[model samples]
Target: MSEVIANMSMSLDGFVADTNDGIEQVFGWYGSGDVAVPTAVEWATFRTSEASAGVLRHGLATIGALIGGRRLFDLASGWNGQHPMGVPVFIVTHQEPTDWAHPEAPFTFVTDGIESAVAKAKAAAGDKNVAVASPTVVQQCLDAGLLDAVQVDLVPVLLGQGIPFFGELAKGPVQLDGPTVVEGQGVTHLTYRVRR
Candidate 1:
């Protein structure tokens, strides 16, 4: 069987991106090296230092396919050949893409709805796990009772205001399974095993 999981890094104040959609606030807080992996030993010590492969470690370990919206899909275009999972990714979008570089990644764009996207992602995933990359899409999975777990890396900083991990939810009574904290190179990782 396969499972659907969602993961993202957020700030202590609960914002994913800056108010202007600029992640500079996020990147600035870490200050130095890659946001995914820090090179400084002290920064690593600040983090739990359990994993070293960046988000790829968790994503690849738990999922065979990744699903996200147009924004994230475009953002990942630069890493076409550097995909960590080496699996297919389904993008949920209305506009069709003209360029195709990571053709090997097996991207399927769904315009119908989240259901269609999830169905296609699962099909592509087969027996492996599927990841809902963006918060919006992740919320859809959660609303449909399709998501299995949620993992968030809680970076130590307050964003004042910005795009939150979970924006306006459709409905609530939302519950969370205990969160496990893991210190990374420059950021603290939090993993939650959400439940009903």
Candidate 2:
């Protein structure tokens, strides 16, 4: 079975976006000093047209499947429907949609539930990791006791209010198997292997 990895960038004060975050602004491809360090955000804001390219490269190469929510899908569609990850992808939504699948990279839409999504992603991933890229889906995975590990990169900026990773945990109780923390480039990256 493949590991369900929920990885997301959160504000230091804990907010994925403002309450009224328009789809255009929420899934920001570039760092706007919102969910990134000041130095990187500044550099990207000033120059570097491909600032987010590095982050995408690092994230996509590490996972075999990408899972996300409806809002995330809508936001990402603005990127010219480019499925940059180039792997099997799953979206947990009430509504059904389409992915402009390439002959080489085909996208799979899983709507039955989170479990179905996980199973399909695992099958698609083989031995690689299945990543839950959406914050909402990550929280649901936790609630459903489906996640095996969580990787959180705590940025320096503070949104104070917006979407959160943990909304209503319903898996009774969850324990973490020690956290590995690393402070680099002004952000603290924390990884916790889930001990369910």
Candidate 3:
């Protein structure tokens, strides 16, 4: 069975990005250590603590597809058509981008909604997990009762104000199960299963 998981690196203040939508403060751990974690793309590689490297390796091996919002897709410039995971990507948007450069890439622009995107991503993922990479999409999945787990790479920082990893949920409070914790150098990886 495929699970929809929301994954993000967030600050102590619950912000994933800075006030200007910059992730430099929160994403420092990606290059703050000595261990090298290579991805499918040649241009992007992570240098992190050995513990973090193990987590990254596991994610790269297990996650078979990705779901993201248009904002994040634009922020990363579509990851140059190849995400680090090298899996298929499903973008949830009201309308597809007209100037998308990589039509041949395994990227699907889902214009219907989040549910449709999740369905498509699950199909693409087969038996593996589908990772939701955007905060808005994560919130939507939570609201729709479509998410299975939440993975937070908790960083030690307080942005005071910024783009949060979670916003107001339409469905209000959502319960979660045990958070299996893994302590890293500058981050603590926490994985919680969504309780049904």
* Highest-scoring model, lDDT: 3
Across 1-196, the per-residue lDDT of candidate 3 in tens digits comes to: 8899999999999999998999998999999999999999999899999999999999998999999999999999999899989999999999899999999999999998888999999999999999998889999999999999999999999989999999899987899998999999989999999999
What TM-score does candidate 1 get on C-alpha atoms?
A: 0.77
Model 1: CA > 4 A from native: 24-58, 99-105
- Model 3: runs farther than 4 Å from truth? none
lDDT preference between candidates 1 and 3, better one = 3
Best by TM-score: 3
lDDT of 2: 0.65
TM-score of each: 0.77, 0.74, 0.98
- TM-score, cand. 3 vs. native: 0.98
Q: Rate the local accuracy (lDDT) of all candidates.
A: 0.69, 0.65, 0.94
lDDT by residue (38-151, candidate 1, tens digit) is 322222321223453455355555577888888776765624634445567778888768787755556677888888888888888888888787778887877887777787
lDDT of residue 43 for candidate 1? 26
Clashing pairs in 1: 47-183, 47-184, 48-183, 48-184, 49-183
Q: Which stretches of candidate 2 lie over 4 Å from their true place?
A: 22-60, 98-105
Q: What count of clashes does model 3 give?
A: 0
Each prediction's Cα RMSD?
5.2, 6.0, 0.7
